[model samples]
Target: MANIGIVIPAAGQGKRMGAGYNKQFLMLMEKPILAHTVRLFEESDFVSEIVIVGAEGDISVIKELVYYQEFHKVAAVCIGGVLRQDSVRAGVRALSPTIQRIVVHDGARPLLTLQAFHKFLEESREYSAAIMGVPIKDTVKRVDIAGKVLDTLPRDYLRAVQTPQIFDREILEEAHQQAASAGYYGTDDASLLEWMGHPVQMVEGMQENIKVTTPEDLLLAERILTQRR
Candidate 1:
């Protein structure tokens, strides 16, 4: 098995959730959503190390949470940058030199099943890069700023991408380096790889793997997590 390291970017200020603080700190099932996410990776035998890139103000809280929870896998709770990509880059830098495979997962996505993640890793072993996604069920449309439909996108050609995106450490590092030079900002890490002409494998993911942003999403996540238990 390859040595794995995880980068969880939790620095986003989720204004949509209307939470006074960072939404990841919000309680979910009697625990913070970030704790749930970290614990999931901490419990995994495949993962050797984990780094959480948090906002400047949240670093102290994150450290306290890790210390209290005894999250041994967490190597550091470093300060993040302005953009999500910058946070991910900072998190990646915090990993140990021994880390071979890197997994980039959202800190808000606490419902990622270990079984699902293990299966994804297994299927992604042969490829240098792979991402989890689910086929879109709803009809997607390209709309103009004026609220008129520009074009209807074919559902078959689209997949809603989710986190726990895995990549070879060296290649991922190189992609980030090149992307920074080109001033290319990708929506996801896989997009950075694609921009560099890397073939990314798409593995099937569960619909429940959602990045919690709004209050409605939090409720749904609780319901799903309750069902899992």
Candidate 2:
């Protein structure tokens, strides 16, 4: 079995959330949002260690939460960098040499399931890089600033990507290195791998695995959690 390590980036300012504080630290069903995300990996038997990357001044708060919650698999809670890619790089650097596979997930996505995680790992084993994504159900259109539809995209080729993107540790590290050297900033982990001429496969992701980015999203997540109970 591959030694899987999980890296969660929780350093984003989340300005779109409109919250004064970081969205990951916001309350979700009486627990911090990021805590729920971390607990999922902590309970997974396949996960060896979890590295949580937070903002510079936010480390103390995350440490408090980890101690209070007694999150067992959290091996390190390190400070993150300015960009999301940089933060992920910081977490990857913190991983032990024994970790053969790495899964990078969003700390804001508290609803990620074990099944999706397992699927990502299984796909990554066959393909060097794999990410969780759902095929777009609605017709996608490319719109201009003037609200003019430039082109109607076939939904078949469109996929809404999600987190828990798993990859072979070496492949990901090399891709990150290449991205850094080229000064290329990718929107997601798979983009970095793709730019390095690596094939990125996609695993089916659940709709419930949503990243809570706005106040409305938090309400929906709360409703989903309530319905699950």
Best by lDDT: 1
- Candidate 1 lDDT over 91-153, as tens digits, reads 999999999899999999999989999999999999999999999999999999999999999
Determine which window of 10 residues in candidate 2 has minimal summed lDDT: 115-124
Q: What is the TM-score of each candidate against the true structure?
A: 0.97, 0.96
lDDT of 2 by residue, 44-160 (tens): 889999999999989999999999999988999999988999999999999999997899999999998777677666666777788889989888899999999999998888899
| CA lDDT of every candidate | 0.94, 0.91
Error of 1 at 105 (Å): 0.3
Error of 2 at 158 (Å): 0.9
RMSD over all Cα atoms, model 2: 1.2
Q: How good is model 1 by TM-score?
A: 0.97
User: Which number leads on TM-score?
Assistant: 1
